[model samples]
Target: MSDRDTRHKASMEKLKARVEEKIASANEQRGLIIVNTGNGKGKTTAAWGTVTRALGYGYKVGVVQFIKGLWECGERNRLEEDANLELAIMATGFTWDTQNRQADTDACQEVWKEAERMLADPETYLVVLDEITYMLKFGYLDIETVKQALENRPLEQTVIITGRNAHRELVAMADTVTEMQEVRHAFNNGLQARRGIDF
Candidate 1:
């Protein structure tokens, strides 16, 4: 073949390779389940970081705070105003704060049901189940229901479950599990949780 013809053939091959790369990248979907467990301060923070990242990408995000009520989460307050996000926090406060086991359980059941809807909805691209492990630990939420939600969530949606003492089964099922180990905490030294930093 002439030199010109050889050059044209090489260009065609390059174009074909580029088209294949585009197709492969487009076909790839994001399906991730991250569990932030262990004793640390940043579990929910890290999960919210992911939510912020997803929101920056124009994806719909749902945040479900299991035990924490509508009191104040700086991140939640900020994201709640965004039209693309939905915030559902159990406004009944902590179980101990409420001092009623049955009531707390009922409240968890109610909020968790709402969270379930977000998990199942394909339109929701990111679902953050914040402090859900506390619900499980308190027996307010069923582990199996949480497990099933993870299993049945939209294949392209990203899910985050953040709390201490994440169940082994949930950890096993998660695509990424981060265990935050607490070496030394200021709270142990009599420092209260600081605003914007801890809240």
Candidate 2:
């Protein structure tokens, strides 16, 4: 064999051994708290991907949407067709459009009732709290209450929260956190959002 071929074989062997060791070390299995947040896009999209995975596995999945029901969301339409998924949308429109703090707070409280129920449900393998951090950001929902619900939830049930500005408490509690940073976006260039792609 050539010298390059021998070196490549050695590199592959080393990588294979490292991967096996890491996999062997990872034995504990528990539900995760995943947070997707940042000023960029794709937070809710990532959470929806996870929800789709849970639903595909025949596991019950729950979704509670806030501050985003006004859009013509193709994802919501697709998710509704799944038998294992329970989707609730708070069509309260945007906060700036509503211009009523009290009304927004009332809407949040009503939707939160469903979220709390989903979190407590043992059969729900995954719950997506879409744009929930907006509630905490606007003080529509209390942080302590959310933290307690997450802590006291079913042991094997995972939760995903997606929004722009996640609270400090939520960040601290998350098992996995991903922040999307925008380098460039088409909309920023004065282009309108596309139907299925942007939504």
Candidate 3:
């Protein structure tokens, strides 16, 4: 082999050894709190991907949508077809569209109740709180209350919270946090959101 190729192969072997060592040392099997947040798109999309993965393992999944209500979502439509999944789209619409603070707060509280129920259930393996940061950011849901629910959930019930500007407390509590940065988007050029791609 060439000198460059020999060096590359040795580096990859060392990296593989490190990865395998870490995997072997990780013995814990508890559920994780995963957060997907940023200004870019795909936070909800990533959470739904996890939902699909959990469902493939025969896990019972629950989804509660906080800021997107009554809108047509292709992921929701597809996920709902699975018998193992249960979804609740709770918001009337975005805060700007609803223009009713009291109504929005009331709706969020009701949706949170459903989320809490799923969190407490041991049978529910995964719970997706889609766009939940908006409710927390708007002060419609108490952060402490939400934190407590997540903290006290079943040992194997994983929770995914998705939205932009996730609160500091939630970020601190998350076991896995992913921030999607937007470099460029098609909408910036006045291109409207496409049906399947954007929604």
lDDT values, one for every candidate: 0.88, 0.91, 0.92
Q: List the residue pairs that clash in candidate 1.
A: none
- RMSD of candidates 1 onward, in order: 7.7, 1.1, 0.9
Q: What is the lDDT ranking, best to worst? A: 3, 2, 1
Candidate 2 — what's its lDDT? 0.91
Model 3 quality (TM-score): 0.97
Report the lDDT of model 3 for residue 3. Answer: 100
Which of the numbered candidates is closest to the native, going by highest TM-score? 3
Model 1, 1-199: lDDT tens digits are 9999999999999999999998988765578999999997799889889998989988999999877755578887777777889988786887778899988888888888889999999999999999899898888878888888888989888899998899888889888999999999999999998998888
Clashes of each: 0, 0, 0
The residue-by-residue lDDT of candidate 3 on 122-153, one tens digit each, is 99999999999999999999999999999999
**What is the TM-score of each predicted model, taking all chains together?**
0.83, 0.96, 0.97
Q: How close is candidate 1 to the true structure, as a TM-score?
A: 0.83
Better model by TM-score, 1 or 2?
2
Candidate 1 vs candidate 3: which has greater TM-score? Answer: 3
Model 1, C-alpha of 195: deviation from truth (Å): 1.4
